[model samples]
Target: MADAHRPDKDKEQDAVRHPAELVAFSKVKAGDTVIDVWPGKGYWSRLFSPVVGAKGKVYAYVPAEIVDMKSDPMGIAKAFAAEPGYGNIEAISDPLAQQPPPDMQNKFDVVWTFENYHDLHDSFMKGASVDGFNQAVFKLLKPGGYYIIVDHAAAKGQGLKNTEDLHRIEEATVKAEVEKAGFVLDEESKLLASTTDDHTLKVFDPAVKGKTDRFMLRFRKPAK
Candidate 1:
């Protein structure tokens, strides 16, 4: 039987260009409070809303620094706020690296970033520097909560060396940085791996666009 709390298969598939089946197979679950960091257009935010169910909450954290960018961050937040069946979701537009609001401290079960990790290095997002952002994620989760990241992959050894110019970061660099923030690298998924990408074009470049090679990483806060 289909899981009562899970989203309909078609609804999930229609939401994103990538195969939703592969994404849904990752370890997110119902009744888990989730944070979707920098949710561009709220695609993953929407997918997570139903999957986490009524008992769970999804917080769409949009860093305040970039909230006024040409990308229309406020419009995205407004759209998410107006969506149905997502009463538990909220959009927070705070400056990056600051602590989440008091009520949210140490309260989330999962904190996720999809395709936006590289933005941490962007000049406009300085307040949410890589280290500060990671630290905030660590502080927001429960002891055993999850930190999930999916991002475009630069060539191995790049070490975020070209993140500003190329907008991709080495997977090893991401793992090292997150591990340094105190999470245990629990698992990895190859569902989004693609070799056809030449690693030269920007992720938004029309050439490779939606098929850019990406790394899917899952980390867990160690239970104390």
Candidate 2:
């Protein structure tokens, strides 16, 4: 381990893409609360642990629908939260629903669903009403808080028709659905956009896994 007094850059090191921009967009800071919705393996949660420091909290949610998959998604997050340095993070498991938990209402500074928004429409998720889910997310945020979404982009006209097969969604469909939930579209980033992706292959395909064209959207809860 390096010295506790290491330079900020050395302390802030990680392999995730555009970590700086993500932090900027989420507006996360010391003592703020946030959630990494369905945090598959807690990659973002780990990054957030120190940024939020001890006073803040990070909820690494594991949607009840995906818990039984071979990946054992929730196990990974739970183990990570049990580790030495990640005390600031917590593991939360619940079905995706329209109602925010009592303690979470108007409590989060940011609710991030990275590469997992399309799963909201997947078949196995109980109560996975995409619009209602978005509405629930709106309830989870504080006034002026942001709901940041990043997901694989499907073809322009396909909408959600291919979600089960391709595990992707149209960027426009994401925007329109979230807006209907009362969140305002604040910004869209092309940082992960890839014109080379043909949008035909499954997101898990070796040819395109991790390289699918993606969209990053930031939607804000009204301050009042």
Candidate 3:
């Protein structure tokens, strides 16, 4: 069920997010530190900030791989940090694939990426390694932590065939890649599933944009 205790501060930003229950899929509780990977404009970061409350923290990590790509990427994270209710949020950018500092190793309770996981396989994001990225995620998360991924879906078992053109990926590929880093597949959410999507057109197609078929996957670090 969707969390009913949402802060008034998050109502606006959280309303526009699709699936309406993505946060509920996360199961992140108060005082949990969450890492929002590839936080474009910090949308999820904004939503997570108030949920985690003053005792918790949210790290909006802008991948350094794209930091210099003419978009002035860091500007987005900086802007969110300056927002009124974001005191518990930290915007971080480094040369690695959103890896935290040494002092923060094994400190995050959750790490999530939404609508951006396919980009990690894009050729344009050169030198960015998915295995390296997941390994880093494994290192940063404490035992029993969670990693949630929501992204545009490609045809089953199609692998990376459409990653560049359609900006979508086969869910099986994602599972294989992530599980290689030792995370156990915990749960799956069909909240964003769409059968009308033929899985051929680019996610940007006007006909399917904003409603493209998507998959929400949750993986957990084992407690022992």
- Of the candidates shown, which would achieve the greatest TM-score relative to the real structure? 3
Model 3, 157-214: lDDT tens per residue? 7899999999999999999999999999999988788999999999989988878899
Best by lDDT: 3
Query: Which stretches in model 3 have alpha-carbon errors above 4 Å?
Result: 1-16, 97-102
lDDT of each model, Cα atoms only?
Answer: 0.79, 0.83, 0.84
Q: What is the lDDT of residue 14 in candidate 1?
A: 55
Considering TM-score, where higher is better, how would the candidates rank from best to worst? 3, 2, 1
Clashes of each: 0, 0, 0
Instruction: Kindly list the per-residue Cα lDDT of model 1 for residues 93-192, writing each as its tens digit.
Output: 7767776666767788888888889878877675456787788889889888889888999997778776888789989999999999899998898877
lDDT of 2 by residue, 1-224 (tens): 13242235434444335666777777788998989998876667877778888899999988877889888988988987887787889998877774876886998888988888998898878656778778888988999999999999999899999888999999999989999989999988888788899999999999987678989899999998
Ten-residue stretch with the least lDDT total in model 3: 1-10
The list of candidate 1 runs beyond 4 A from truth reads: 1-19, 22-26, 100-103
Evaluated against the true structure, the overall lDDT of model 2 is: 0.83
Instruction: List the candidates ranked by lDDT, beginning with the highest.
Output: 3, 2, 1
Model 2 misplaced regions, further than 4 Å:
1-16, 101-103
TM-score of 1: 0.87
| Residue 216, candidate 2: alpha-carbon lDDT | 89
